[model samples]
Target: MKQSPAPSLPSAEAALPRLPDRRQSVQSAQTGMVVLKGLANIGGNAGLTALAAHVGESPAKVHRYLVSLMQEGLVDQDPATQRYFLGPELIRIGLAAMRQAEPIRHAEPALIRLRESLEVTCFVAVMGNRGPTIMRIEEPGLPVTVNVRAGSVMSMLWSATGRVFLGLLDEASVRQMAESELAAATDDMRALLPSPDPIGTLQREVRAACCASVRDTYLRGISAVAAPVFDFTGRVCAVITALGASGGFDPSVDGRIAIAVCREAHATSLKLGCVGPPPAAG
Candidate 1:
């Protein structure tokens, strides 16, 4: 009789342990995204205990991850408050990521054009849960210039971009956002909203101010005009605004700059595949 054939060895693929189902894998990924996104939105330095509560995760689990993040410099703790904000490393990663996105890359040219045309500082801001974030800025050449640097966070209630964005969103949503998300206000923010009516008036004005120029308080001597920039989904993803010394921009010229800024924003939106019809001509 022929000898039995030697037993076959298990293949590498078969030798590996079986993986979890697709649904489980997807759930795990979604949970992780939620945690990271929530952390990013928490604003200034947050405590591990507070973060865990916010994310609805156990402190032990959050502590382990926070320690890991801290080691990698992706999160930092304030010595005074002992809370954590996004770390410099996270910002570096974010900048790198923004550089690779097509919408941001395309906005660069338009930002430069607006700055050159207006002869003042122009900023391109993207919507964030907190408010509008200054993603890019083309500073004016003047020695005494208003400096709004990249990553500056402007209030959705005070800044032009913030007003424009609030205008685009529905009333209920806007109120909900203001009350629920931005519940905590800074001293400056409290000063801006001396009464509740100003917020309502701003919202109503935002609705009427579409493709139009509106003035609101900034710092004591600074002012700006803003217009919305839509994305492919017809959602306003960004806003382009022109800022200058309060006295330097004449009302007539300011109107013209606002119109030009709006026009350019529309053009940029179209290039980005915004589905909505072009904003009514200014």
Candidate 2:
């Protein structure tokens, strides 16, 4: 008798299913995140077709993910427009994250990097009641002699740091303070200001440059560059400044030092939730 035909082995396709792999689980999580981020990048709301195109996924796959996100309150769709938008939970999470982000804390690393790489004194200055006040400072091994300290208040018309605030902040308080300072400026300080229309000219220049640099204007032999660090609302929350002896520092708007400062400020602003291109260096 033909013995029973030799036992046949199961083909791979006929084998029983194995448990889901860990990597697949991780990938699923990552894909979910991609969907969420894609929704945010496209003005925070979009039709399923648009969102699928933006995320480079099929509409069916995106819809499945969107359903899961909705279950978790991370996304929601409007019945009338049939468009998906970020949900309340996601907004709450973002707001909570923003509340935890401290401008000084976010800027400290940039300040350290600027100080070490550029061999200059770098600081974070905030608009305080007195004016722009230094909140944090980093100095190189051989620091320059700039009398200012952590709490030192800078002059709106005299300091590179203050000028960034003066140019970016549109509040009447800032303008009033600048005017008061200009009115009380000594003959030497007045002479140092631009002729004809110092305030108007300074604001226009700083806004145009997206940064401010001064040479031998704030203090004798001292040069500095300052760039604004904006918050999520595109408001100037602080200024990052790097200063050194005029002989060693290049304060030109397009110079290496200024570009570095602007880049660093832009990075710190990103950490603080600001969205946009980096501040213009030149």
Candidate 3:
């Protein structure tokens, strides 16, 4: 026994797997990121105490970091309200990002395909500051007569694209927009605005269907069918419209081009992450 003492076994701690050293991790970056994310979520102006609570940091600590953020132009404090807001840098970045977005960039090929297959004039319209404006256009080789260009603004009540946006906009907003149009209405447009009821009726119908149609509303003998395209935020990012002679294309909910346009719009919407019917058109 004295000559054969039992050999000692390795300890349990030595039997465990090794974890890589994390000494290179930057704690300051972690704090800065946390603070920035918190500020973004808070949105608008926030005071020191309010922001501190929102970010789960002490007021003094948050203030110190905010000062650093201000130096980088990532934050701005109001001299009057003593509230902090996201700075001009974020605005500049956001505007730049939006300029590059071109929501209908990938949708052009689909528009071309639809036009070629349907033999109808097709276009994408997005809500603009003035109203629903055509962003892109695709036409069949044949002589079509609707007279709309890429910059053309459509009637919020008369055109299919316009109706879709009207359906998506709130009542007050629609009323205000309608009033503005009415103030500048020509004799022809005055005829269109006999009363808001007609436009209201169209808005209700479009909202119910998430689609709309126009026959001789914008142009006599011209008919159009439009379907709403939704984006990730559930807003109607764009409207796809198919147009041709009144007799050539059907504008009903179950019409030929209506079905096709809706299908194309649905496919486009899916690409942009829409899961349900469009919620907004802006």
Best by TM-score: 2
- Cα TM-score per model: 0.55, 0.92, 0.59
- Candidate 2 wrongly placed segments (more than 4 Å): 1-19
Better of 1 and 3 by lDDT: 3
The residue-level lDDT of candidate 2 at 189 comes to 86
Candidate 2: TM-score? Answer: 0.92
Question: How well does candidate 1 score on lDDT at residue 186?
Answer: 70
After superposing candidate 1 on the true structure, give the runs of residues whose Cα lies further than 4 Å from its correct spot: 1-101, 170-177, 180-196, 211-216, 250-254, 275-277, 280-282
Error of 2 at 282 (Å): 0.5
Off by over 4 Å in 3: 1-101, 171-174, 182-196, 277-282
Instruction: Compare the candidates by lDDT and give the number of the best one.
Output: 2
The CA-based lDDT of model 1 is what?
0.70
**Candidate 3 has which clashing residue pairs, if any?**
236-280
lDDT of each: 0.70, 0.94, 0.78
Which residue pairs in candidate 2 have backbone atoms (N, alpha carbon, C) closer than 3 angstroms, thus clashing?
Answer: none
